[model samples]
Target: MALQLIALSPIVLISSYLPFASPSNFSYPAIFNFGDSNSDTGGLVAGIAFPLGPPNGQTFFLKPSGRFCDGRLTIDFLMDVTGMPFLNPYLDSVGAPNFQTGCNFATGGSTILPAKANSTSPFSFGIQVAQFIQFKTRVHEILAQDKKIQQFLPFEEYFGQGLYMFDIGQNDLDLAFYSKSDDQVLALIPTILAEFEIGMKELYYQGARNFWIHNTGPLGCLPRIIATFGMDQSKLDEIGCVSSHNNAAKLFNSQLHARCVSFQGQFPGANLTYVDIFSIKSNLISNYSQLGFKQSLAACCGYSGLPLNFDNRINCGETKNLNGSFVTAEACNNTAEYVNWDGNHNTEAANLYVSSQILTGKYSESPLLGDSHLLAISEI
Candidate 1:
């Protein structure tokens, strides 16, 4: 399959000094994001008052910035290319955030299907889409009543011009593994993708024309999964990852890719691009030493222990009493040297590398090298 690049329709800009100006020929007036922690800017923290305390954002933001990772995610890197401000969470009302460019409905621990009773996040994929609808409706409502606040809200046309991005489904697969057998989990992929299709259809009907969809990465390689399932030697793969989990992820991605291909035909006016995040991340894990990462599977911000260093009870940036001693899951001395950040997320360095690969268009089904619009974005 040819790598399908993100091709946006060119819109003439009157001013070159606009804050949302894109250096590239293509200009996405805004970006509407949806998914889990992989792309969540801050929805989880603001929505439920989740305590994502210190050391989470110490490397980049130098404070708790609502991200599960230590720094910016791959979505953040992609947003920088458009020269727009980092998207504010839809649930966040603090600081009177300006949503002129975009809003993020993603939350940490979100799933495509409605969450279970004990789930940490209540804003499931369906809820996130509902929030987006409310946001769009309110934007128009407020605009109709008053014109003074127009500067802070997205233009009516931005809905069609902006990029709608998704990076979810990892948690859905993870949740299935905890209860269902391998065969049962594989059987659930079709149902999960069906829900995803419904959400896409909703967005398409709502005037969202451009879409950038990312396939889930190798969940088997996550430090959290390996620490929990590693004792069972029979379940391990050649590279020390849980074979069953990886297989499930592959199956999910395969079905998702097919769905995206079909969506192109279903939504005639939409540009749906499916990015292969699995290959990029799997390669990084398999060749970490060659890629300048010291720890491939171990977490940088996790409980202090050899190998994986992940404790389910003691999350990253958390302190607890263990074995008559107080142990805090502090971050490692060097972050860039580790691929995994806190067992479940990737490090800032890893995210940067992944975004670079995305821009190269090599990970996509189509070529990205010679596209003038793609080459203009800063490589960093």
Candidate 2:
């Protein structure tokens, strides 16, 4: 059976148990995000050899911002809702003028675990945390040299009050699945969570108090997964997703949720909220019609004529076929009607929906962002 089902009722039901945190007067001065392609703004494009071009960011930016999707990612929308400027990638050639606001340390193919033996890049979560540490030191140095910028150099004020968002672990799980048995993959969960715990503790030591942690989504439902692993009807669940893979994702989320609960108990005065992206993605699939999504199991952009309209060899923007023929990948006229943007990511519209759900604070473990004690700090 798939891992225990998450509450999929209306938003009201899911949020009924959450303690009310009023949003009447709340604001976040900065947001520091860490993750992989799911939340990468431009780090991957700037640092890696990944191919990200047109048609990827056509829906919103009208040009590529190095995000894997056509428009804004969930992190981008979160910033918009919080009134923060879109985060600049830490690796961007043109450095952001203001580190006071925050910077993104996420790279596209980043994993929580160190890069595998065969992996091409070594930008793991550990490295991102190291970068954050370097950034903190740089801020202190600048503050010491110039009194004019000292206001922005308040490490405790900014780091303690800022919101830290994490959207990693998907790539780690994906690698595990392809290389190890189901039981082996399950065994890796504890190690992954340990890395997360260590990372969080380091941040806490550095004055980061508030955190928004997103669990992995339904991996089996991705277009690429459906094409690769859902070929057999018996293996596919009622939702046209591979049951085994989805079950694995559920297991990971379950363990992660429990860890978050433990973290709350272990760390005094820390606000670590777990975001249930698994349930949100599942709900979207189960309620696609109500959500105005016409295609829930296929990609909005990919090579045409392939199973589930996804071709592993081609990306979203490539217009030439593998045989050197001129053939463009099919893209939906209205991306808003599709849940997936490419084979592995969500469309801008779907991201908008997901971000709205997260903002509702119902999906979080404690007081929603609006009611978060971190936001209560009047300094911002």
Runs of candidate 2 with Cα error greater than 4 angstroms are: 1-25, 95-97, 148-156, 367-380
lDDT of 1 by residue, 272-368 (tens): 7788899999988897776767888999999958689899889998889988899999999988888899999998778866776676666665112
Q: Candidate 2: worst 10 consecutive residues by lDDT?
A: 1-10
Pairs of residues clashing in candidate 2: 56-70
Cα lDDT, all candidates: 0.84, 0.76
Candidate 1's C-alpha runs over 4 A off are 1-22, 366-380
lDDT of 1 at 178: 88
Cα shift from native, residue 155, model 2 (Å):
5.9
The Cα error of candidate 1 at residue 256, in Å, is 0.2
lDDT of 1: 0.84
lDDT per residue, candidate 2, 231-253, as tens digits? 88998999889887898899889
